[model samples]
Target chain A: MPKLDNYRVPLKGPVHLADYDPAATPFAHGTVKAQEKDLKMLNKQLAQLMRPLQGENKRSVLLVLQGMDTSGKDGTVRGVFKTTGPQGLRMATFKSPSKEELSHDYLWRCHAVAPAKGEIGIWNRSHYEDVLVPLVNRWITPQIAKQRYAQINDFERLLAENGTTVLKCMLHISKDEQRVRLQERIDVPEKRWKFSLDDLTVRKQWEAYQQAYEDLLEATSTTHAPWYVVPADNKLHRNLMVNTLLNHCLLDMQPQYPVDYPELVGLQVE
Target chain B: MPKLDNYRVPLKGPVHLADYDPAATPFAHGTVKAQEKDLKMLNKQLAQLMRPLQGENKRSVLLVLQGMDTSGKDGTVRGVFKTTGPQGLRMATFKSPSKEELSHDYLWRCHAVAPAKGEIGIWNRSHYEDVLVPLVNRWITPQIAKQRYAQINDFERLLAENGTTVLKCMLHISKDEQRVRLQERIDVPEKRWKFSLDDLTVRKQWEAYQQAYEDLLEATSTTHAPWYVVPADNKLHRNLMVNTLLNHCLLDMQPQYPVDYPELVGLQVE
Candidate 1:
């Protein structure tokens, strides 16, 4: 078993997807039932940890999730935060940029929903998608992609300095795993609603997407906000690892609960 | 029984809040249980009506909700949309604008989330707030408010012409009812999370908000997208009225599935 930091993209070198195994479950050390129990405990701890963040009302946290389709971004949200509840957290899903959003810089819409003081703002898919999708499809040049990486780092550093802890995660899943999930979505009556003809189109560009992800993970991994590649071929293990990483970040934040209001320390209310 | 159009703000002349009784249950007849039964039926019908809109994939619907503090915008959404489910509906709640959002023209953020083709988009306190809040708080001049009215009309008309059905409802609740709801938030321990001290400051400006609403309603109620004032003091009646209005809009849309595609008429999947 490796430490959590082992998954963090190295800050000083090139990134290679081959270095990380998508089927590995290095974070979980037990059977499926034992891992589920560990996840239940982690969710409870996270819910409690979020309270002081809300009470202090001065700092915030943002968890960014980026992955290919069927990589379980939505599932991770539901599974990890079932106990943290909605009030303490916000889930912002950045789909294709809208006409008005396109009228501004790429980060305009993302900044508009930055977690206010005292909330855990989670992005199911985030600003990273802007870079990945365009870069993979040849809609943007390598020079432009490089420029975006610098811009993203600066934007994130600004948030970090001004009361936010930005954590980014790339749900790393195997191509074979995605095929099974896509097939289930097509074959199962309940899940068939999600079967889109477009999914197949994107799947054809799998290797290009993997290259794009490797590029972004290398370029944007900064000290202020680093990226983590979570091996997410196993759904349960993905939830456990992501939740554990999130809980670790929250503990590190250690938001304060103000205990200094002395004006009416002993005054009685009528 | 008053017809649906009876509650629509007339397309001409000055408006008066005095004309409507906020506590009246004119839209709901019979027992509480009976109204509950009717709502359940309407929810199912609303669900069925929304599917065709999705299948046609040619048009969309936008439902805008605006009201003063504690006037039940959230409640109406939960009640009316309980059965429409989440698949076809996109609820965009517009809170106080951020610095980035404020930099854009008022309608920029609203337009960014305008429902895609074949979806029912709901705005819980929408761009209408831009007009109402600023006008009441004296953040904008009368001339500017009048200018905004024209701008909003033009914006909405564009959406209508571009295949979006715009339905606006102002959750009309009496000041006394607002006080009751606010008090419950303060008095109940569970709801204390919702008791914002700022709400008291806003409550002090009740009459000003009503005037703002009346002004905007009169100025922007065009034939393309009219404003409906729902008597929202009674929780049940508010749900019934909103559900009925929404159901009516979907029925009027008359979206259909083209079940005769010659390209696939005889195609078979092995």
Candidate 2:
């Protein structure tokens, strides 16, 4: 099956987000089926690539997925990563750092959870928290923390230089979109536990966070580790775009089997 | 394919483990095509049963497996958990507590990582550290630490009473068998990183640790949250036993689809 070049949207800049309205985005994309089929096919190819890489243990992939609460980070993980062989996949979801993490550098906590060689580590929320939450809370002076942006770029560049393929996604959603989601959580008895007042406070500072995110993206979007600002107004679109990026990244890695292992020739099933 | 009746091995207290070696229990179950076929069949049944239960979201399963270093924790996870659906399954591995964790109550750190409803959480090593490590290091009195075993049981009972099914495993390997495996690690450059001088130090206290573990298993294993003692002499046996126990747990849960969700009957794909 041919890959869908036409469906691939050009990388949008920060300015393009002006038209963003999560609720306004139509989820009934005409190409949903085709796109999903492509994702499945791409995932199969990725599985084939991943098998040999497990034995080689040379490179590690860090998949950093950052998004607003209820913007489908968990769903994206479920859909895209469901097929990757379990052995080499490591997932680290960062919660609030512990007291020890506060004593040292912010990156210290993240450093401990980085994926090992021949592994794929999913960071549900990662070092980006240093920028996002601290910036939102005014915990650090803008100038001092601005240095962290470069530090992060260097850190990611170091990872890439030392054989890590970093795929970062920012799941973007509008304020109105978040309100609807928050309401869904409140209204749906099953989802009540997921709702929190802090979600509303975060939604209130949406624009400030957006500008902070935009600057962070502009500063750190290296050729080695590009950040995809995913439009997450439409959950379907968010899922699709994230899957596309993941499929693309895995395909780019082109993982191959170690040559030393004995090749299966005529081994028969008993 | 039919279900294999549970393979029961009779092992009584403190058998002079130094006499028995891995060679004595070399995986003699050769060419297991039929067994493999039955396993696959059982896995499909288990997955089918688990699919809908995720939506019901009434209960979660916590699988905690611990053993001496190189006792096949990762291998068991790989073998037994291969077929679980990604949506409802999560895994958390606890290494030595970071400096931050040391300051807090031991259970506090663990609480942050517990599985949500309708999920199966796998803890590679867990809160048992409060019991095991502290006791090993003489950081706490055995009397105080023995209280922890009761605390753990009650904690699990709380989780079980409120919709969590906890299944814990202790992989039992003889000292002679472990020495052979440790030797393999030292001889093979690839596995050398896994071996450490600390492992030998721990080996010296193996009997004390074994007694500690026996007390732990005896006190904590209950009907709601039973402990599965797996023989780790043979990797294949360990893997198969783990797979069977997991199969049984998922079967017992009998997860069904939430009745609230609309049925997929005549929906158009295109």
Candidate 3:
């Protein structure tokens, strides 16, 4: 297995999307059957580890997933969390901002829902959307985007200092792979409703989105809250990699069941 | 099986807490082993039913639980949802109002967190707490409490009008049962942390609190949002009754997998 650090964006340098291979299966080189087995094992460990985290109840987790449409953000959530099954997980998916949301600063909405202590909070799409959408579409000045980056870094730093493990994964998928998935949405009756015309519009701006993602990945990948580019072209491999990263981070935290209460020794129920 | 309607508070007339038998197991008179098996089946059914409700994306469920401390409100949430496992469920637990919360009206905090569309929201305790605590302790005048009841009814009516299925349950535990449970919390080392000294202070006013619950159950039990008093002394029976009511409500709503897209017949994934 490769060092997971091999995927973390460098803190001090510009990033190029071309450097990462979206098709690489460094984390899962096994046959499809073997990969499925491995993913099942990781998922079980994640579910078990959550007991101690919520039992300890002092710290929590925030997983932020940002990716282009048809890039499997929703799929990643279901696949990665299927075994864990929301034991202490709270997922918030940010759609286009409502009128009330737009009236506030972008982070205001994000800050409001930060996981309460002891929860594993998942953001299917998050604040990074602000940086990407506006920057690509020129809705915000570059200077404002830069300011927002610094603000995001500061906010994450506070969460880290106060016991939050922030993990951000940008589901990396090749545009060709996206075309296949987008068409699948259009083709499957059960999935057809998920297809939207706006998705095609977003696909048309693919290069601009790639540039925007590269820019933000460089600007916001701080020491406290790093960005990981997950190779998400293959559905099974994407689930495996995300679950692997999640398991490693949770095990590293090493949350424990609380110590036994000495004062209640030999006490009996009435 | 006994009639589930046996527990529903009548839409008109006063509610007498003493009339309900907290120790009764009308719905689950089977052996403990059999009751556990039934609950497991119900839990699986709840998990299965969540899919079509989420896929429909039009309506949602809001379940409110109110009960005395150690009456198993937390236990009910854990036992009932242990299988559902939070796929699209959102759990919001209301504790004492924080400084910011006190500034707004009582329902403001609750209204903000009411279940989103296609989500089954579980409230460990809810705006109903406002009626119970303040009215029991005389923090609010009788006139104020009466007015708040109307406000609550209107708020719930609005939610029902907007496609939310609201079900409220009051975990009815005898004072003797509560005493045993509270003492166990005090005695068991693993459960010692859950024992709050303030709970005893509240216990001293049990009769008053019961009266408060009775008053609110009468005022707020409407056509749209009805309250059911669960006989909660037997934990298994409590779980069974609550699950039965929930399954019935969900089945009645009858959310179906959407079948709207007609444009993509015979299309194939590239």
Candidate 4:
């Protein structure tokens, strides 16, 4: 297995999307079947870790997933968290901002849904969208985009300073891989609901979007909440890598069941 | 397996808690191991049903759970929903009302969190707590309790008429069962956080709470939203019964993927 740190974007350097191979499966060390079995085991371990995390009730984890359409953000969530109890996991999906949301600062909506202590919050598309979408469409000036990057870093630092451990992943997929996935969505009848004409409009700006991601990822990768770019063309590899990243974060936190109630040690219910 | 309707509280009749046996495993048709296997199958089917439900995005389901302490509400959620994707399931846990909550009508907090279209909402404890706790403690007179029951029925009707299928389950466990479960929480260090001295105070009013439950169940069991008394003393049996009930409900709803999109046929992403 490759070192996870290799995937982490360095805090002080430029990040080139070309350096990461979307088709690489560095974390999958064995045959396809074996890699699947490992994903199942990792999922169970994650479920076990969730109990103590909720019991401790003093810290939280936030997983920010940013990816192009058909890059498997939804699939990653379903695959990785299939074994977890719904009570311990909170999921928020951000699409085009509503009028009310646009009325406020972009960060305002994200902050309102930030994970509370003792919960693991999943943001399917997050505040980073504020930077990505506007920049790709030339809606925001480059200077304004740079300012937003610093603002986002400060926002994440505030969460980390308080008990949140933020783990962000950019699901990196090749343009050809995206073409295949988008075709599947269009061709499959049951998946037709997920297909929107707007996806094509966004796909046309693929190169511009890639450039925006590269710039924002370099600017926002911080000591407190660094970004890890996951090679996501292989769907199973994407799930496995994200699950492993989350499991590692939880283990490091070392959440334990609270043990401070001396008064109830021998108390009997009526 | 026993007929599920046998457990349904009738809309036109009085509900007698003594008539139900908490320890009976009517739904557990075979050996313990076999029943456990069936639960796994049911969980998988529920997970399958969730996708189409979300794809249709027109209807929803709300599951309301109410019971005395140690009746296993939390355990039921963890067991039944273990296989579900977190995105499709929205869980709301209502504890004691805050000062702001107290200032509003009892149902305000519940209304704010009702499941949106295409989601399954689980209430760990619910607005029924308003009827249960207050009436048991004599904080509300019988007349007001009757009024609240009517109000609750009307509130649930609005949800059903608007496409939310409501399923309420009362986890009925005997006093002896509660004694054992509460003791386990005290004896088990990891579970100690769940114990409270106030649990004992409430247990002392067990008969009063039971009476309150019977009265409310009879009054609130409407055609649109009915209540099922789940036998919950045997933890495995409780899980099996609830899972089966939910599976039956979802199957009856017959949620399907939308077939209305004609604009994208043979359309290719550029």
Best by TM-score: 4
lDDT of each: 0.83, 0.68, 0.86, 0.92
Instruction: List candidate 1 stretches off by more than 4 Å.
Output: A1-57, A73-151, A182-208, A211-223, A231-270, B1-58, B74-113, B116-124, B127-151, B183-223, B231-270
Q: Candidate 2's error at A48, in angstroms?
A: 3.1
lDDT of 2 at A75: 70
Tens digits of per-residue lDDT, candidate 2, B1-270, equal 213222221222333333334333222244567556655665566556555556667888888888887788877766655555244567777878989998997887787778888777888889986798778778888798878877887888888898888888777787777877877766554555455567777888887887677666666667666765667877766766666677777777776544342322232211
> Scored by Cα lDDT, where does model 4 land?
0.92
lDDT of 1 by residue, A203-270 (tens): 99999999999889999998899899999999888889999988899898887665554432332211
The candidate with the higher lDDT, 1 or 3, is: 3
lDDT tens per residue, model 2, A89-163 = 777777788898889998888888788888887888899888888887898778866899889988988889999
Regions more than 4 Å wrong, model 3: A14-48, A51-57, A83-88, A141-144, A256-270, B13-41, B83-87, B141-143, B187-190, B262-270
Tell me the chain A TM-score of model 1: 0.97
Question: Which tens-of-lDDT digit does each residue in B1-270 have in candidate 1?
Answer: 569999999999999988999998998989999999999898889878877787777899999888888788877877787645355566677889999999999999999989888888889899888888888888899899999999999999999999999999988899888878887766644445455667877888888888888999999889888999999999899999999999999898898854443333332221
Q: Candidate 1 DockQ category?
A: incorrect
RMSD of candidate 4 to the truth, in angstroms, is 1.3
Better of 1 and 3 by TM-score: 3
**Candidate 2 local Cα displacement, residue A163, angstroms:** 1.4
* lDDT sort, best first: 4, 3, 1, 2
Q: What ranking of all candidate models by DockQ puts the best one first? A: 4, 3, 2, 1
* Per-prediction tally of clashes: 0, 5, 0, 0
What does the lDDT come to for candidate 3?
0.86
